[model samples]
Target: MNELRSWPGLEGDAIELRLDNIELFGSMMEIYFRHAARLVYNSDEGVLTLERKSFVNGLTEKRQCRLPRLRSLHVFLDTSSIELFVNDGEETFTARFFPHLDDRTILFGTHGHLHMDIEKWEL
Candidate 1:
């Protein structure tokens, strides 16, 4: 079981990643997007796997990737496409998927005892 931790100082318009009571059980992170915006994550691993589901019609897309010592990740979203950037723009992974704009909640976790700091904003 994973729980959300406590984090303060969010700008009140963006969502901050909370890790006070949350724990991860896998080597992957999960996030839900509700609107058209960008999502980013940073880690030391040279590889990553992404899993996402659309809020409308409950569709899903999955992929596995090998990045270049991923120190950061950036996801740019449009109405029908998603562009993923890794390592401060060192690499890019792009795909197309449909997710509900109204269901903007995102969930993130890791596969092991991985720790991270997460933040989000509405666009």
Candidate 2:
């Protein structure tokens, strides 16, 4: 099943999460805003994608990196970039983003129920 967890109006430069029973396939996670997504993790393809949409609705092509299957994730966000570390830095993905919206949201989806623990902090 698909699951989405949204955190709006969060002012932070870093985010961390621990997921229990997260399979490498049939799962996806997104960290985004109204205008852009900082990151999208697709387990099935072992890809971590980053994208941005312009103010006029122009969207950038996704940039991808291969990553190992993970149950734990850590993210660092700056004014114009994001850094992702998986499974205690066994793998990593990094990218740049420019978001037009001030509100930020986190969306996590899985084929089945999985327990997740998340935390956010301002840099």
Candidate 3:
């Protein structure tokens, strides 16, 4: 079980994280983004969770989910929807309602410490 480390913060067109030479676990990666960012996981079987607090109505939304072997992923906020994609264009996970307070940050890690080379890109 290796210790988890966080990458630097990015703000621009888009930020991408790439991990190579590492094994992936179901739920072993966390990402924090500043100013609402998207997350994409390309691995065998993985899990994702979102944590945020509301200010307008004092509401809180936290979600955790599992994904099958995927080829790609995308997330973004328009007006009132969170969109997700998987398998290079096979499946997608979309949800309604906004639950992001501020552009805090993004973190990535694994529950069992999967080895990987991660890269964050601004797109």
* Highest lDDT scorer: 2
RMSD for each model, in Å, please? 6.7, 4.0, 5.6
Q: What would the TM-scores of all predictions be?
A: 0.50, 0.62, 0.47
lDDT of 2 by residue, 1-123 (tens): 565655453554444443444444456666553345656667768777777654456657566667755577777766566677777777776666665445455555555445556666666
Give RMSD (Å) of candidate 1 vs. truth. Answer: 6.7
Per-residue lDDT tens digits for candidate 1, residues 4-72, read: 223343223223333222233344444444432223232345456555564566555456566544445
lDDT of each: 0.46, 0.60, 0.47
Order the candidate numbers by lDDT, best to worst.
2, 3, 1
Instruction: Give the Å shift of residue 54 in candidate 1.
Output: 10
**Candidate 1 ranges with C-alpha deviation above 4 Å:** 1-26, 34-46, 52-61, 117-122
Higher-scoring candidate on lDDT, 1 or 2: 2
List model 3 lDDT by residue over 1-123, tens digit each.
235355555323334444344456654455444423334343445555555445456455556556655334455434344555444445555655443454435445455545555455654
